[model samples]
Target: MNFLIASVSSEPSIDHAPFILSGVLLSLVVIYLASKIGGEISNRLGLPPVLGELLAGVIVGVSALKLLTFPESGSDGSDSVIMWLLQTTLGLPASEVSAVFTQVSDVVLLLSELGVIILLFEIGLESDLKQLLGVGAQAVVVAVIGVVLPFAAGTAGLIFLFGMAPIPAIFAGAALTATSIGITSRVLSELGKLTSKEGQIILGAAVTDDVLGIIVLAIVASLAKTGTVDLGNVIILIISAASFLVGALLLGQLVNKLYVSVATNLKTRGEIITPAFIFAFAMAYLGNAIHLEAILGSFTAGLILDESDERNELQKQVVPVADLLVPIFFVTVGAKTNIGVLNPLIPVNREGLIIAAFLIVVAIVGKVATGLGAFGQPGINRWAIGVGMIPRGEVGLVFAGIGSSSGVLSESLNAAIVIMVIITTFIAPPLLRVAFGISPDLESKELKTEVTKES
Candidate 1:
């Protein structure tokens, strides 16, 4: 133990004892407070609370406040004390502690995945399947175009501008493919368009976009790992994803049927909610094992359940859990981000930033055209559809995290991706309002109408 301590000390300035205990406690409190304040501010401005939460994170992180900083090799920085303390408490090497922190970040990420899945499930549950079917082709077209264009633009631009190696650039483009459906959903809900036919198509298309983005991420990850993009692997992933969806739907139907039988016969709830949660987690695990995103599994579980009968009850129960866990995911996402890494004082390459900027533009423009994919749908403005798809939120951050951990993205690239995420999230609300021509007073009336209609 003494030898180990000496070795650890030789490498860095971490004191190991007080740092670990204090850091964890401090991090939790800061994250909670930041999220609360950020969420409240965001709601007041008609923005997704996530934007506020992230901004709060930025405020607390190294960028503005300089309150927290991750330690770097040979850097004489104030955050080094905190970083050292974390290293010592974990009783691991500095690198190992960083790895552990990254893993913990994944737990938060998993919950974020759950949040998006639930959001999508809610969309599916509320949807008129018949109406969705009618607009399915249009949604598919728009989603595909929306995904394809941005991906191509981002990949090409990164290759040309940043001279990034092929695989990393491809990963960057794949990262841009994600659309934050929650952003669009909230905006539409505010605009009183959530029940509109266009709204339905947009929601459906956003789902499609997310699924496609995940596939692309998997492919990019595989390519980065092996230095080859295998057609067979891509085909297999697609098949697996499709199979997962179908299997989930089938299982959901079976479960719903069984529940109906039992409920009708016994007139008991039968602790169905617990099993539902179990099934959701199980699906998420299975998805990970299959090299697909866990969110897909959670979403499939939501789609499979008896929405007609249990939707409200399930939402009420699940939302509280989502509320508690999901914010940690977002706040942790902010915590992991170190904006000081972007400072010119840092001896990092700037090419990543240039590539990141190009990709950000591509991400923005690509989804905007998805609205055009709403072609021939009455009362649907393609621009609105496109704007709705702009918020990258948690999904984009997930991709960035994957890329960073896998070495497909360097630190500078990761920072750039974080900046892009912030921009995309920040821009969505105001742009959404403008696109839909929704003013404050008009929005108030619409909200009243929705409340009354629901009542």
Candidate 2:
């Protein structure tokens, strides 16, 4: 028996109805509580909450305390507590129990996928296209350089140095291409410099980076599914993704207008938010239909609806739902990780560690090189802007998750990416402080001052 599964099998069987109710409740309680504690600790340590959540899952996962159990592949294993709960207590047939477990896993996966959609949509809702455009040539230059250099460096390094296969290498390179501006934005905001030229450029560039990253994600996922790469197919995929965004945006405007009109007349609950979610979900489905990631469509939906007066209310309603679901996704990503691969004593594990170290170096350098893209604007702190873009955070994790799910990244490579994410996230706050010559205390004071001024 797989030790992990066997450990869970010691639980006593209960009545069918109670077993399911208690099992689900107990599992979620453990996941939520553990993730929460971990995130709190991480935040106290100046690390990203996602880091803590991931670690929490690892602590409770198969490779560790085995508090949570997933069914093992093939036979030669005892049923896990989860499996036994369904099969023995629930009196499900062996095959039905297996099917039920798969369904349970699928539900978790689907919820995580939905969390991604909601996250992208929230990002879109917060984005101001006019302001992004106003940042002008500097933003465009930074975004382009940021995307291209990191991508080229990551792909080339993986291919040449690590001898990674082309397809997986491309996925790795693409993972390096996105910058999670949220971390940088938060730090800049704390420093009372959100409106500074450097800050605006970083914000604009990060937005542009997000757009490009989603498109690249679509392209890579399509490539993975097709198992081949060709110019024609690539062009088609690009066009399909673009067209889906355009069409969804145009149609979504009409949908929003109709929703508003009907809601104003009907005076029903969830009028604005309900339609917003419907449109987002519909667009996400449409994106998947066209072989694009659902986030592209959901994000575009947010962009479109944001053009209306209903945006604030939509955001207000969505935030609560997002708060509840998003953490689940991050925790699941962590749970799926096999941290055993991080051990350097094992040969393959050591290789992964080396690759991770190299990727971290590449991730930092590539973004730093993007500071050069701020060329014409000599007054701006170009290097500071580069440092600002360095933390990949949630975006990198999302890409890694997608790559793993799609089979485009092996376990070793996934672990490397995760390590890169953790280190970058941990370091970026202090690095940004140093780059900008601001102390933590000064940053806090500045933030408080700004808040008072605003008030």
Point to the candidate with the largest lDDT.
2
lDDT digits (tens) for residues 108-216 of candidate 1: 4454455555554443444344343455788889879878998898888877876777887788788888887788788788779887666777888777776677657
Model 2 residue runs over 4 Å out of place are: 1-23, 69-100, 250-256, 438-455
Among all windows of 10 consecutive residues in model 1, the one with the lowest summed lDDT is 69-78
Alpha carbon lDDT of each predicted model: 0.67, 0.77
For candidate 2, the TM-score is 0.86
In angstroms, the error of model 2 at 243 is 2.9
**Tens digit per residue, CA lDDT, model 2, 191-223:** 777887778889999988887788888888788
Name the TM-score of candidate 1: 0.75
